[model samples]
Target: MTKPPKTAQTAGGETHQSAEDLGVDALTTNHGVPISDNQNSLKSGTRGPTLLEDFVLREKIFHFDHERIPERIVHARGSGAHGVFEATDDISDLSKAAVFTKGEKTEVFVRFSTVAGGAGSVDTPRDVRGFAVKFYTREGNWDLVGNNIPVFFIQDALKFPDLVHAVKMEADRGYPQAGSAHDTFWDWASLMPETTHMLMWAMSDRTLPRSFRTMEGFGVHTFKLVNAAGKASFVKFHWKPRLGLQSTIWDEALKLQAADNDYHRRDLFEAIDTGDYPQWDLGIQVFDEAFANAQPYDVLDATKLIPEDDVPVRLIGTLTLNRNVDNFFAETEQVAFLPSNIPPGIDFSNDPLLQGRLFSYLDTQNSRLGTTNFHQIPINAPRCPFGNFQRDGKMQTKVPKGRANYEPNSLADHGEDGGPRESPAIGFSTVNAATGTDESGDKLRVRSESFSDHYSQARLFYRSQTEAEQAHIASSFVFELSKVGLLEQVPGRMVSNLLNVDEDLAKRVAAGLNIPLPMKAPAAKEPIDMEPSDALSIHKNMKATLEGRAVGVLITDGTDADELAAIVEKVRKAKGKAVIVAPKVGGAKLSDGTQQKADGQLAGTPSQIFDAVGIILSEDGCAAMLKEGAAVEFVMNAFGHLKAIGANDAAQPLLDKAGVVPDDGVTGLDSKFVKAAAQRFYAREPSVRTLA
Candidate 1:
């Protein structure tokens, strides 16, 4: 098990304590003396000053003072939930991992995180998301730490610190918090050509995922799977969400960040709480060493990707997040995942980034855990039986009864059993297939020739996007590069890199930036004609139902209760959520004199936060709410975001004020209009205004 990276914070107004929740008598001093009081400081007298002789007081206070560890330079802000991964299909031919054996269910913990924000930062930022999972298998605990994006920025680990330094808050001015729109980032990216592939993904809608349930997870590096016979094969891991991929528009995301900072977390929690558990199918792209060597590019390159067309993903298992954490501090915040935690049959490749990760993980754990025995934390410990000769470190809880710690001792065969003997037939064994010898002193740093062509995959990614999605990518580049203050003609430099991807893309981005298009584009080893992969497009695959989605209905004084009840019943039957909003905070009277209070006032809740909007206002209320700025924005944003808007006859003027054309998305709906509002409006979006 690996300790959490620095930057886990106590949420909101909670205090952080380093000790486990085993009570006062359960906790002991560093010198093995039991502690009776952990809640209060020991004093000279009943209410007197704290005494220096009270080592218990000193230990508690001293630990509290240094409770916070350093945050990760990236992926600081995150949310976690407990879940179970169940094997739905058998894939014993691919590997011998016990967790994937037929008809097995294992406990798992997953953490979803945004890559570039503080722990308390808003959830809907434009950034790559982390999708890390830890599985407690029969053999041991295995961690599959990965990101939503299938590829990474650099091919090697040597450029990791440099990449993070550029993306983090600028050195001189610590402004632009939780963002990447700066001169330093573009400057570094424009110079390093390999970043182009991932930049295409980051600029696309994948970075702005609508919900954690809608995004996919990739291992991002090549790995190996060894069978019981010691035969090894190359593999890649994938987690495809059952709901498919979806993302919010940039304008909607910005507004949602202000309206509800916890949008994604709230959506996930409510979905599980309502028994609509989010699920993803575990997949593996299996290949042999001969096939890996036959590839045009190095399979070890982190910046490159193998097209799914070449090696299709085979689904083997499913993971469902069915439970929320009982305590955020003890479980979620303290849970740790490291790539080095691999069960038998699953092994590592020669990817440089992965090699560096093996060393970086344990070292970073020490900084966060503050002790060598951080694994003793229940969340990090394995559920299965585990024992070894090693013992007695800081925070040690176990006490072996005998002194026979050595395995080969003559006194071990007695009742006091010596350490367990190794079983080679069942134990993990490393594969040794290397032909090159280390004693020849042939070690030298060099980039493989197969990893040189970086622009082909970038081109493949761009060309794979739909026309509108490609336009969004170009617009996103324009928006981010426009914020670079010091770099004049930075757009040209970025577009120059894009020329290697596509001439039309370079021209469009250049036009958006008000610059001249390049004369010619660079060429790739394989021409920029890779077949488009449907998995890459968010707009191409959206959920057709409104389950786990929110709808806001605006009401006013003297509104019809029967009509409101009908709409609520229809939405509820579809597994959708509905919240009421009124012109005033305290709400208004209905036709039957039944005074119902609203969940939020019109000024506080905006229509942009919901998937659909309803205006069930009366004639007088419509005229009154139309005069308010928030009400106008509520209706306008809903239409501009291409959401379904159901209105009453009296609400026509509000729709008119919002400049909403009477289309399919704009309907005079009652119980009958529930069906159309559930599906996404891809056709209606083109008629709306493009913010960029």
Candidate 2:
């Protein structure tokens, strides 16, 4: 009999048992070679670069990469655009990368996507949004790949496969696409306390973005910027939207899925097509080793974040997507982003998740694009000069001019000037000073002790939110957990984990599900109360402006032309889009006997997609609108969604029919409507919906 390996408890009190002890098949390579340590890759030391010889990782990731044919395993559903990154501030003190040179303009491609979904999934799902930018720098292509949320669910890269697998559609049923509110996700999350922080973000309004242009983007991992003096400063990248932060209500997000499958994609395309370029100010938080050492949590831990209050973000550049994709398949689909594609001055951190990503993304591109020559694709190719001696892989597109395939040869005499000889001064170099704790030591597969305080930031995020936002989070929890059927213990187990975040939050979720409160999950490190960051709250940081917003104008037959024109003018002047909605796709006859052309039809364009609504109906038009279900919903949904509604006196009957309550956001068709349309009425949420 094979003797079973021993089981030990982690600091979190979760018992990790061996395969034999768990009565499960041993995890092995594709060739059936036994994997002794599947949880961590082989490295020179615990906090060191992953060794190239880790076949377990290679096999697992290699297989995972090709799981879907011609589609990404994650971030498959994407919307991309051509852009230019303009360096607005001089950051020569920070890095030598020419992309950071003042007044320098770098062509860029930005891909925004949702994780845990297929290419066929709807755009408006409650999931982490990928924000990856490929900067065609003078040095090289710099791929600053990240997400909308600042923090990730797990610390180590080894757990990435598991985390993604759990959140993906369950294998047996292959259902619940593009969403985390399912049995497999909760069951896995209930056991892993590290997921708590990101779960908070995923459940929040952050996931339900109003537009791709409005959401914030984060690097999620600490990186290094090497100055001309070889001075290294740890940096976190941020993309602050020019339009400001905006999000939809949970109900509004769901309705948007039904209203338009490609809501975000279409919005992005139309905005760019109409010369409304989406812009984001590139910001960076620069810190030193001393400041990093002083933090309560490790900066290398991907699950944690350094609040903007602690280290304020410095705006350095602007990212503007001014052009839509010419071809979706050739440009958007084939564009590959590799974490390894860093410019000379930019370098990696010892972030475990980042380390794994550095290794996996290149392989992913190869698998998806079906060749080693993926860089030959115009979208992924760098605009800067590039050459190498090595050549001829599958689908080799470039032609090498000379016989200089190998390095360290006197091949210049053989009609070639030794193709792309190494230039140490001009090329990329690594800062070799000690950074991570125990940079080199024994080859042990271990989780960092510094990464154990999982619940502290989670608690901080919850406490930071406003009361209304808190209720949305709690309600989101209830809605997600209620989907965890058959796994009866999972909901309670997840609630226990939530108890560690906040007892009130746990109780609210428990009450929402009609379940008794469970004891708090054991802490790996006792969670300490951290200071609440106003920057973390979407509502607190939201900009109250109509710019980049879309206002739907509901007009019917015999609608007041003067009122319609006034409302449209106000919206345009405020830099907001005015989309005319009517009973028919064609023009609607107005009071002035002029035909009012509509941007969308009543049944097709639901109120959920718009920021605010305006109803300009005559008495007969109101009667006609009241009889139509779409018109009634157009008003009801706007009210239910907490959007500003401006209606003419004739539209009062339709408003009353839709159960519209009078609030600050509910105003007559006047100047107040434009002001009110600029923001959402959060106070009215409680009356409109039953939140946890």
Candidate 3:
């Protein structure tokens, strides 16, 4: 700067040519007016308040103030990605939807969300996840609005609002945001017998999915598939992850919330950006009316599920997410999904909850978007051509040239312009099975008797779990019930309901809470002791591979550089990521006198965020880390969580300080360590912490 150098250092600290020298375009306002000074507001003096005449400041503030729109009522916190859904198997025999034609690729936008959180909520909450996908098909936009869990909390749509209100934060306190471990929720749940089945799933590890890529999705309602000949078959939709199902323990999930608020979102974004595209198989469980009637429970019941043991899932298609959204608010936020957005070949069942959602979603879009023209938004618009008689609503972007706005008009014969008319042959047609009333014949507001047995599946779920998983489920119930401070009886009432599901489970939860076991609650229908289904257990179904997992490498000054590189290479060879954590953000100098950059700082990034951990320390580094609490916690938490731990000889002191006992999962740095790190040593859990 003393001699006015050729390149000047910008505010970002990088030397660059001036805008004029670089021939860059000048900044302009929305109206295309040149903006001379954007750094400072127009003012009477240097320290004066912004002048009213400053149009730039006024415009910017006005737009900023109105930038945010209303968030979704339930699935408020979400992450989305652009993807392609490819038909791998021909399902035209089951349905005539073109998207099911073998080898056909359809553009899709998928959003993964937490059900009971605000837009600013953390990602690792124990809650139901909304898995909604909008397929831009040739016929129209087909939205598959579903959830990670197969069943819901209620049997009928009428109880939906009450369920949501109870789960949400209390109106007076407005506290306990993004959680359902309060008195109001437990009190309401204890009174509603239909919630028993879903509560079991919600309290289990299913609600604590490790990542969206490892979670299973369900349509949550019985639907129908109509063929070209108008023959209908009842179906259930399932999205099975390519990586297999996986979840974090309750303790790990709690710690993850503190380590990274955007854990899921960041994982999705980074995965897509790095070309590690996530994939899922679209599976369908198809059955006829006879099979549906033959089941122990009603197919029309929203609270029930067709066990995989009963009806095998047929793999029909694959969905791969390969791109992150360019603008999150423009694409992910403004996108609207409705259960009513079905293609011609697909139709709905008479499920009471499904019926209510068909009306609720359309009405919600109207109120939230403040216009019926939300269809005009690019994200929500259909890919195929669309036209209608309706026009001139708020935010209308299309200009229609026509004298006739209504259908069944003769304006075309008089040479006046007429809009497009509905197609009779190729357009949408409602399935005959969905058009009539049920055998009851009366339009009464009542739940079907077939939907009454809720505890049988709950028992099936509990008995299906591994011993460790069952203990975790019991502990989770005790933890959540303990948070219900307002009602001491609410915990007992919940335990009483649990008695109908499994007496042992009820006893375990009661013992954990230090409360006396209550008498069994009366069930509308006695629970049948259904054989335990292995498909319902996460541990039984987990893939014994390290692919798509992550590991954290703890390093310090003078650590072996060759060992660090070898560990990272091994992880990459296994299709996993190895992140480096050091004491300082600038990282440390290795034994080879080479500086290596750290992916994260030790204090900020905890071991909970990774599937496994490795500690490579020098003798001096070990001494230094002994006095650091975070270093001790890094090893302690990983060992206590039953995660595989890899360490060098020098790291023994730090491991000893953290009370890490030698186990199968705790291995010295070697080829065997990589394979061991791929799995959680559940046998070591009992030695580390006592479970319910």
Candidate 4:
């Protein structure tokens, strides 16, 4: 009998067996040999070259050399967490998927990523966000891979490579990494009319999301849901944040890169770690084949969207991310998402982009993961018991018990164990409609005429935005196109494409770029002014509440403790966070002679990271801060970014120096300041900066 290891309590107050007490068997080399000393390699002297005969050193170095798997080609920079998906409404009539059964709670892992840039890139780039969720259900693993935007740049899958190549860093210069605001992207986008609709969204405030928790996600392609009776219906998936839509202004987004490179990633990690779990309601727009046929735009077109007003979204589930990953590399990096990983109740549509993705994801995973058994990786593995005749691939983890690795084996007759068999009754089946076509014809390389109406939805999106949002869109276009120095004609061509979307938008962009307006590009189909959907506008749909938002309070030595405490308490009561930003991390000494700690230092954490800002200072503190450039810029930037500001009487001189005028958003520290901090003052934009 082995002696039990001695138990000890960790710093986190959890009891665990002491590693040293576990004995020699606990620490071992790859070959099962016990390691005596792992801290140092075998060297001739204390600071000499390592000996080549040291097997432990050799093994450790060799393993470290191959430790990293290839990063994802698209969504390389990502963050993940563990969570549960709870089905709140019964959708058995639409799909027989166990994950969709009422009251069923399926364990899930979710990864959010930026579409462009390498693993080392900053999080605040203007790029599409990948929202991929892997659900470990009773049946099998199901991956819902989607984007924050509802539509895509191209309708056909073959054009995906070209689109990515254009948006990525230039091959020769390798410059403008992690952003599309460059020559190559605008040059390619101006030439491709199919990209106009998506370009509109890319340049909008949607690309500058304040945080991942506040962003909305959509399945870019239409999918099919199959019932137990073999009935299929067209479906589109959506994830709406409970906190509502919120986006940073263009200037604020730029400042955020300088403020904190991992702003979004840190925000998500801290939110979950603090037990303030982020949640999204899963909704689906389900319609029959008849509804698809009646739509003016083709259902298979990836650039088009079914308006929420046309087909109301039916809320079916809620996904809450309550736990953070224990290991970033093993879980966040190794996890793979396949669009084709559908369960028995789900099927595919003829959406060409989706069809191409189904094949692309699996192939990419194989090449990147360097194994056909990538699914065996714990993060990507199925939770349910799974057995198959497929055996012996690279990195195979399971060992089949018997010699009968093939189907229809008779090893059981000899009293030997037989492998598991398939169940056709519960197995996944493709929808019958997948083989049928509305207009049957031979396969061809040409695009369908129904997919050519590229400008209508672009126009619809632009016209639907509020005046302030439209101005932001126009300014973004100007900023991106202005960077196209290599192609002198690119801006004009892009402006021409914009003409089809909105004439005023094109004219504004042209004026901002100092270029003459060009004629509208020839549309394959004429544009139509579709009715504006209020849901398409962020400002119109945003919840004017401070819940889940952060407020930064700038303080210094001799600050008024009572005023600072009161504001912080009010923010907490509103379900908002109060971050103290002081001149030093050691924080300020209040008038009461007590030293306080700060959440951030003045120079590192800027006002851009917070929803609103409050300045609480004593006469001496205010005088000291007025001399510091960071303090002036903090208040000035907050006002310029259209954020609410709260100030104490002692901070009046600092506000004057920062050029802040009396506005509804700029309030004294009182009950009114709390209410004002809940929302932005968009009307104050003109006084701050010029718009396109």
The candidate that wins on TM-score is 4
Clashing pairs in 1: 6-71, 7-71
TM-score (C-alpha) between model 4 and the true structure:
0.95
**Residues 230-335, model 2: lDDT tens digits:** 7788999999999889999899999999999999999999999999999999999999899988898999999999899999999999999999998898888889
| lDDT for position 145 in model 1 | 90
Per-residue error (Å), model 2, residue 430: 1.3
- Model 4, 1-692: lDDT tens digits are 23335676679999876555766345667777656579999999999998998999899899999999888889999999999999999999999999999999999999999987988899998888999999999999999999999999999899999988999898899978899988999999999998988988998888989999999999889999888888888899999999999999988988999989999999999999999999999999999878888888998899999999999999999999999999999999999999999889988898999989999999999999999999999999999999888899898888877798898998888998788887889999877554245554797898888998989999999999999999999999999998998789999999999999999999999999999999999998999889999989889878878899999999999988899899999998888999999999899999889998999999988999999999999999999998999999999999999999999999999999999998999999887888888888999998888889
For all candidates in order, the CA lDDT equals 0.81, 0.91, 0.90, 0.91
Which residue pairs of candidate 2 clash?
none
For residue 645, model 1's alpha carbon misses the true position, in angstroms, by 1.2
CA deviation > 4 Å runs, candidate 4: 1-26, 39-52, 434-441
Per-prediction tally of clashes: 2, 0, 0, 0
Evaluate model 2: give its lDDT: 0.91
lDDT of 1 by residue, 1-692 (tens): 22222232466866444334322233577666656567888787888998898888787779788777566556777778888998988777767889989889999999898987777788897899999999999999999999999899998888988998898778899867777889988889988888899999999889888899989999999888887777777788999998878788788899999999998888788788878899999998988767877877788898877788899998989999999888776676677778999988888888888888888777777667767777888889999998887778887887876776776676665766676678788777766432121212467797777877878888888878877788778889888888888787566788888888888888777877777875543534444466777767777677777776778999999888877887888888987878899978998898778997998898888987788888888888888888888988999998888788998898899889988887777787665457656655656666774523
For model 2, give the RMSD to the true fold. 17.1
Query: How well does candidate 3 match the true structure in TM-score terms?
Result: 0.94
Q: Model 1, stretches more than 4 Å misplaced?
A: 1-60, 405-415, 432-441, 518-527, 670-672, 682-692
Question: What is the clash count of model 1?
Answer: 2
